[model samples]
Target: MGYSPTHFKSINPYNEEIVCEVPMHTKEEARQIVQNSQEAYINEWINTNYEQRAKLLNAVAKEMKDNLDYYALPMTEEMGKPINEARGEVNKAAWAAEHYASFAEEYLKTEYIESDATESYVQYLPLGVTLGVLPWNAPFWLAFRYLAPALMSGNTCIMKHDSHTPLCALRIVEAFTKVGFPTNVVQNLMVGHSLLEDVIRHEYVMGVSLTGSSKAGAAVGAIAGSEIKPVVLELGGSDPAIILADTQDLEKAADVVVLSRYINAGQSCIAAKRIIVEEPIYEKFIDLLKERFEKLKLGDPKDESTTIGPIARRELVEEMHEQVDKSVAAGARLVLGGQRLDDMQGFFFPVTILADVEPGMVVSCQETFGPIASIIKVKDEEEAIKIANATDYGLGGSVWTGDVEKGKKLASRIVTGQVSINGIVKSDPRLPSGGVKKSGLGKELGPHGIKMFVNTQQVWVGPVKS
Candidate 1:
């Protein structure tokens, strides 16, 4: 392959080796992609009945399931997600496909509205062509979460996946082709951020769906907005996991927090970054978390015995360590690990936990996209709620309490898009997942997600008699 300054190089995060280098799409190539998707949608895909769409989607799901190892192994190699978790992500993406196949017809059916006209109703229609700008953390899962809905709803898509995980992106297109999807119905535009504006501004492109950092979101959002098109952004998050001093268990609560904070080596956008505890049980809960952190095995992601793996990039390692040092300088105590595992081959950072962390500390306020958890002590439930909402992000968070009603009420008070009570925060294909404030602008799953790139057209046949 010819090397260009703008090409994407797939690097294995585990050993910091270049797996492959793929050149990005040129401006002309990107324009052709949009044109092909638009033509496919208007001439073939749009006329396809819901049953046919469902059937094809189901077949794609099966293809992915049958070739699980093919997709899962490369994902682990490229991004350093644990082998088991990588497998789980592939299955979860398959589940999303099956889910949309089972529910798309019902979700997009015509809705009748009572009015003076002879008949008034609303129907959801395809927007022809849409763009998906996804990240590397959960490549397969994020792609399907956006693709399943858009495709099932009759809209063709062009996916601009992260350059760090090009193999995962190419495999997604290959799966659709294996299942007999029409050409260009779901294409991967292998391009870097430099060409994003030209893709979004393409005349044939209708809408945009992005899952990336807040800075990337703002840039994409502005470009899409200038063209007067709809854009859905699932951006960065510093979600809080709040634990109350209730009458029930603390160990279970600690388990949930640890899993949320450390899963994917703390690379998930929705992963819990801030840990808020009621002062009465603050030190005890911190001890429980540190013990669990010490137990996590930090090694090769391909090893079945390893739990936590390396960060996706070497630059991220330095960036995260800087955050930790700044937080410690600002009065937060580094209880456990606070440095990189240099003895390891690749980009590995040990599970770091900080205590006595105030609300405005560097680690507490900024989005730490790695395995560093900031522990904050709040006096009571009121103070806990205050600390949780102090950050600008409104993505996903969790609350722990004995009383279900109290937990639900507390969950409502947290200024985020979705909150869990006595459980870990996660994105489900069955629920609408998004954020508010700086977290993001639109939802990406469930019934709400499918509608993000569609045109809700109103139909009325009327004869007014005065």
Candidate 2:
């Protein structure tokens, strides 16, 4: 099913239906949009003080909250996130706007530094336009992750959202316009991957922020590197959830693992793709996972009762099956699910669990982007830590244990950007989130995030004094 190069077709994953086709912007059109964005930044938005930006951002928050379903249903129809989760995502985006609206001033305030000069300080100033290349999953949340801070910092934005989610992207831009943001302050550039280099290399785009696969990140990073423009990448992840033997509450631990791994049909970049269990409780944990996997309801994402939804694309369904087949052939035992439900329509895959999975297997080393959990049994904490850090990607993970201090220490040893000691790993507006290693570069969603698209200039005043 190939689509026209000049247009993007939004196909619903729940039923394999084509929702709409949005025409891709031509190179010249893209240039004009970027030009307008730059003009807006240099002429109006840059002069708009933080108080004005804050008021507008708060208005956006209220607009989203007032019409939550209006912005959320498109996400469900387009990307197949469950209806309830889709609503929550809108809320998360709104919360992020409120967060930056409240905190951007403090985060970007000039800092006085102790130096030999009479007066020295550092200031954060906006860089003209930032080009955000976002992914299909969590479209609203990811876009706002870059937008809230980038806009609050007095920069205009040009969003290059994934082709699979054009409607969501349009809605996002619509949200900004409804709040009376100046024209072109935030414009959605509907273009294919082939034209991305041109967009990044555009003179108006001073920085780039991307959230996608490692391969995509590498390609974009290379182009941005050549252009010498700042870029922030939030890439792929194969996160692990470690269950130490000393855990007093195995049931709660099991719940956390299942929820983290299965939410959004396990399409999340930070989902618990691997579950590392201490050997003593391996059997019990496997049993818990099997029972929970059986109970999860998979159906229309528009259904309120549905717990899991369809994979965003049919290609993802086949890719996940390939991973499962290879892992099983490599000696990973299939415990609960091992195949897609053929009778079901619209790219449905059950919650699959593989037990006795060892390191170096396809499932262990590769980033599994669907709802298939690989269970690895480790003899001790040392092995668990080793296995957790074994992957090429390190974004986020969780460690469950009764001993808080020991859990914190174990979390420190893991080579990831963030970890939660007895909770599910999630991205919050108040905290920073990103990855290390192949997971990508830079951070998002916190004090550091606002600075990613800004110029950190240092000022010093010196006078000769005897």
Candidate 3:
């Protein structure tokens, strides 16, 4: 039959305006992704040697780096993510390709082992075609996170990206092909989420990975579980940035909070949504934060001077506005920067700080994926950890203390899958990225992430000569 991607709009979150109307793939068309990837996997890609796969991955990373500005510009235009943020995602996203390029060989190699009876061996095998239902906020990074690892493990990828980010999903497929990946190694489905459950139920889809909300993750988990197939989920986070009274540099702590929350206009799952400061330094922290927020230029992403820009979508801006309103209704006070910039033509919610934020407050428990942080004062590290761990999320957290031992100790106690001491941390290809509790199951990015889709095989012999 005939097929065409459905129409979808991406609004400039800065000024509440339409940025673009993208064509989305229909369910019928979406089915092609899995079919094509499956064909590629079993036909040609599966047989490609590890050296060739690594070479292709490295070429893709190089292609991405070479065209960083081209990708970043479009990302900023479509998603309203600040220019630098999009560029950094490009750089960081390339790490996956680089990582797989250098490491996939050793990772997939068969290893010698010994059993009591005789000789033994261990080898890794790849799963078949995998479906990745991706998110928009960090489109390039998330899409490739699955691509790099899955391909490294010998599994071809079929991706159904967020409708709001169809261009990003398509562009990534282009990147793969440009880097010399054979046809269908990574296929982008321009379809709607309506087709997700049906596609995951497809026999060709051996595994799946999703990065989105908790509710969404649960739904995917249920489907994948029922199918008895594997899935990796990296869900939501209201990560906390804990500040100690004895922190050596209060200004640096404030700066860290500002940068962490405002990146991508705070549309990150691991963004520091909560700022828990010890009471002794709370007032000073607030003052410095206000000063820094004022200095942050909020305007056009292409402008070299703009540090913050419109959010990704208008609905997100409205939602963020409602959150601040509900927080006020619930007795939270704004220390500085709340509400939308009315004159701007994009979806722009000003960087906001809600003080006296309590657990049930709108800005407290909720994962406000905007430039908003709920600030709470704590008497000591115990309360800081308590407040930090109070949420259903366990994605990421940070501890600020001059004492290295105390910082490390506090990080150990926090429930998050990743934490940083004295600085804000993003997921590195070197460190596995996943979460505990409600955040997600399984992992992505590092060696463990790459191996998640791999099958371990053991072979045994009757006896040994020795």
lDDT of each: 0.90, 0.92, 0.83
Best by TM-score: 2
Q: Could you give candidate 2's per-residue lDDT for residues 210-259 as a string of tens digits?
A: 99999999999999999999999999999999999999999988888899
TM-score of each: 0.98, 0.98, 0.94
Q: Which residue pairs come into collision in candidate 1? A: none
Model 1: runs farther than 4 Å from truth? 1-4
Which pairs in model 2 have colliding backbones? none
Better of 2 and 3 by lDDT: 2
- TM-score for candidate 1: 0.98
> lDDT of candidate 1 vs native?
0.90
Cα lDDT for residue 251, model 3?
Answer: 84
Error of 1 at 41 (Å): 0.8
The runs of at least 3 residues in candidate 2 whose Cα sits more than 4 Å from the true structure, single-residue gaps closed, are 1-3, 464-466
The most accurate candidate by lDDT is 2
Q: Which residues of candidate 3, in runs, are more than 4 Å off?
A: 1-5, 12-23, 464-466
List, residue by residue over 302-384, the lDDT tens digit for candidate 1.
99998998898888899999999999999999999997678889899889999999988899889999989899999999999
